[model samples]
Target: MLRRLVLTAAASVAALSAAPVAAHADTAADLGARAGDRLTVTVTDAGEGQDGTFDLECRPTGGSHPDPAGACATLDQVPWGKDPFAPVAPDAMCTMQYGGPATAHITGTWHGRHVDASFKRTDGCEISRWDSLVPVLPTTAGA
Candidate 1:
């Protein structure tokens, strides 16, 4: 019957659409397993003995960073759906007080995406952003 034929065609279409979604999920998992995650962080003007470039790797965590374990743990704690390296919103109000003369640049892949984010401690918002990463960006507290 025509009805039976139409139903079969619709089922085939649905299965075909679902196949791509499943394939994409599998590919993403494979990529994660193979590539893992890596990052290169550079800091300047932090203070005495706190300025340099460091490598950080996660999902097994080993690199040249001073505290790779702590840095990875801090990064993992970031809430899902939130970007840890995102810049402060332009409309947000921030304190005018200066935090310090420190600046940092972080570049590499995270969560399968390329990242090149910058951090500074010029004001309240920027300082807060810098502090959130903790060991990843040397603590500028009381500086």
Candidate 2:
């Protein structure tokens, strides 16, 4: 009986050990661990019939970005979501007037995740979003 009990206990231990352990990725650590990556940014101004493009490598902050440090800082402040880009506030109020034909397209990997985001100054809220991403986009809002 004692031998049977020991065998049962050993079997239970084996079963427990065989159970799969779920491993969760730590976001902050994962992001921090990545080497800086390339980001392609393009800005369009319909009023001027012009489009500007820039390639940026953030994190360590390099590339043609006007102010890589500031832009990366702004991006770093945002919390990571399953979706690469967080949704703008639904309850946010925006002005009706068109801020102009300023549009920005950003695509690449950030924090080891693929990112594709578009920005436009169509309203007050959108303008805010565009302005907040300054240097990341261009600085020619008035033009």
Name the candidate that leads on TM-score. 1
Q: Which stretches of candidate 1 lie over 4 Å from their true place?
A: 1-17, 20-35, 141-143
List, residue by residue over 33-140, the lDDT tens digit for candidate 2. 557666898888834533677788875678877667877777766665544344467897777767787787889887777778888877877777777766577666
Q: What are the TM-scores, per candidate, against the unseen true structure?
A: 0.83, 0.66
Scored by lDDT, model 1 comes in at 0.90
| Clash totals for all candidate models | 0, 0
Per-candidate local distance difference test: 0.90, 0.71
RMSD, one per candidate, in order: 3.1, 5.2
| Tens-place lDDT digits, model 1, residues 1-143 | 99999999999999999999999998988678535789999999898878999999998899999999999999989998899999999998999979888899999988887889999998999988988999888986445
Scored against the true structure, residue 70 in model 1 reaches a CA lDDT of 97
